[model samples]
Target: MDYERQPYRRCGRSGLLLPAVSLGLWHNFGEGKPVDSQRAILHKAFELGITHFDIADRYGPPIGAAESAFGRIFPRSLRDEVVITTKGSNPMWDGPYGKGNSRKHLLATLDRSLTRLGLDYVDIFYLHREDAGTPLEEQVATLDHMVRTGRALYAGVSNFSPEHTAEAARLLRDLGTPLLVHQPPYSLLDRRIEGSLLGVLEQEGVGCVVYSPLAQGLLTDRYLGGIPAGSRAAEGRFLTPDRVTPEVLAFVRSLAELASARGQTVAQLALAWALRDPRITSVLVGASSPEQLEANVGAVDGLEFTDEELAAIDRAAKEAGVEA
Candidate 1:
């Protein structure tokens, strides 16, 4: 694989430059699949210049199974060639400290996640989400400590509101440690982040690798005609038929038409639109198969969107009440 074919973008104002498209093992690289499949995807992604891979503590269907699989499959020599990012703070099961943004939970969960990943340190460790109950100070302090101790190279936060993001940045900056990135729900369907989160990231120099840029396949061509077998809408908990109303299909067709006019697929258009922003460091995508991974990475080549194309996409998305 020619890495030069996949464009790389600087992560905000940071010195780090990550591949524009990142491979996320949030869906199929977990339990209930051939372990070889997970290894294949990771190897394939790296070969395709997808230098960054995203995972989480509770990523597996049965929880921790994904990490265990990664531990078994990923080779130690290939580890330094990639940037491994995994989130903590989510509990695998019911427990007090099992879930929270408290310093104790973040530190403990990351330690467990590392053991499962079988690595001395993760490239980027995310806080998963903010805990209203736990003080932001504690969260930032613990993350800084991880960086200081070399348990984690850099720390980031996900699923945080713009206001909370600002607060966290302020807290970390005061401690002489700046937040690395913010993972937010972003896509043609979810534009809420465009309101202020994008603005905050610009002002704070915080990189953003938005997830679900396809709105869980809503923005894909998969549901344009109907939900196919093994489609996420049919097999996953996140997307449902209730989401594919007549109005949505109508919008989908129009969007697909718009994408075709540009000589790109809906998935390519959707992912490309996201990379439009300079602040966006990467688009974390979940692939159910290697074919899907190849198609998703091809999106990087189709990322040259004109202003007119963006305007048309916005109008079409607005008709369905989707944020573009």
Candidate 2:
């Protein structure tokens, strides 16, 4: 348990200090697994300085199983030591109103999420995305209501564009609650956030905890030769086998070379690259086991990047079709 803590970073301009590396159960922590195996990953993450764990209602195949899994392991004594964040309104019901940014949906979804997680409140709750049908005011106010009524400590938005994020931030500030964070896909293979979302976060002081920092493991050495059996892309959906082409493998190898020079892994280097930006409050990662959680958590302490090293990473990422 004496693994190095590394350091905690300020969440945007907020008073909260979050670990540089946070664990996410968006995948892998699901049904058909022993509870102790999952609990071991959770505890090991905490033991390795990963204080934040992110989840969403639609985590498992049938949905809500991830929360229930955590519900089993979260004894009251360990609750205060960590930060738990989850998102709501991603379609857990058959009705049209089951998902989206509508006030009714958001509030109801938060309640269900809390019940499943076995907690009175989450450290951070996200709206998940923009609802084209729901008015911005309705969504913002509903989340604000959750915070006001003590359902969630701080509110966040994920997969939101810059325009929507700005409008939501303005509304939250007017209501005396600034949106605390923005969760986006940011990795060696994803840089869409750098164009607009980064600007929004900089101006609004809303922090970012980026997911897919390893590009769903494409940035890892496992895919450099061929997709391993049971790998994430092999499990396929969000990351497809089509994503792993000759060019993609070549780029991963190039990045692997860079990592080798630094005595690190492509996965470690990829996560470190995201954390290099102070604006990114944390790099949210997923783990299939306690060992994966510990190794990913180990990346934080070795995250330092020299100016030249940063440029090399940019070139490799560009070759991989990732916008630098």
lDDT tens string, model 2, 1-324? 332576788898999988888888888778987778888888788678777889998898569988888887876787887889889868889887788888888888889989988899999999887789988999989989999999999999999999999999999999998899999999877788988889999999999999999888888888877988887788885889998988778788888899889888888888888888889999988888888877777777677899998888778767766455
lDDT of 1 by residue, 1-324 (tens): 457868988887778889999988788866789977887887778778988888899988788877778788887888777888888878755678778888878888888889999999998999898788988888889989999999988889999999999998889888887888999988877788989999999999999999999888888887878888877678767898788777778887888898888787889888998998888899999877777888888888777877888888778877777544
lDDT of candidate model 2 versus the reference: 0.86
- Model 2 residue 291 CA deviation in Å: 1.3
Per-candidate local distance difference test: 0.85, 0.86
Candidate 1 has an lDDT of: 0.85
| C-alpha positional error of residue 79 in candidate 1 after TM-score superposition, expressed in Å | 2.0
TM-score of each: 0.96, 0.96
Indicate the worst ten consecutive residues by lDDT in candidate 2. Answer: 1-10
Displacement of the residue 52 alpha carbon in candidate 2, Å: 0.7
| Clash totals for all candidate models | 0, 0
| Residue 46 in candidate 1, Cα distance off native in Å | 1.3
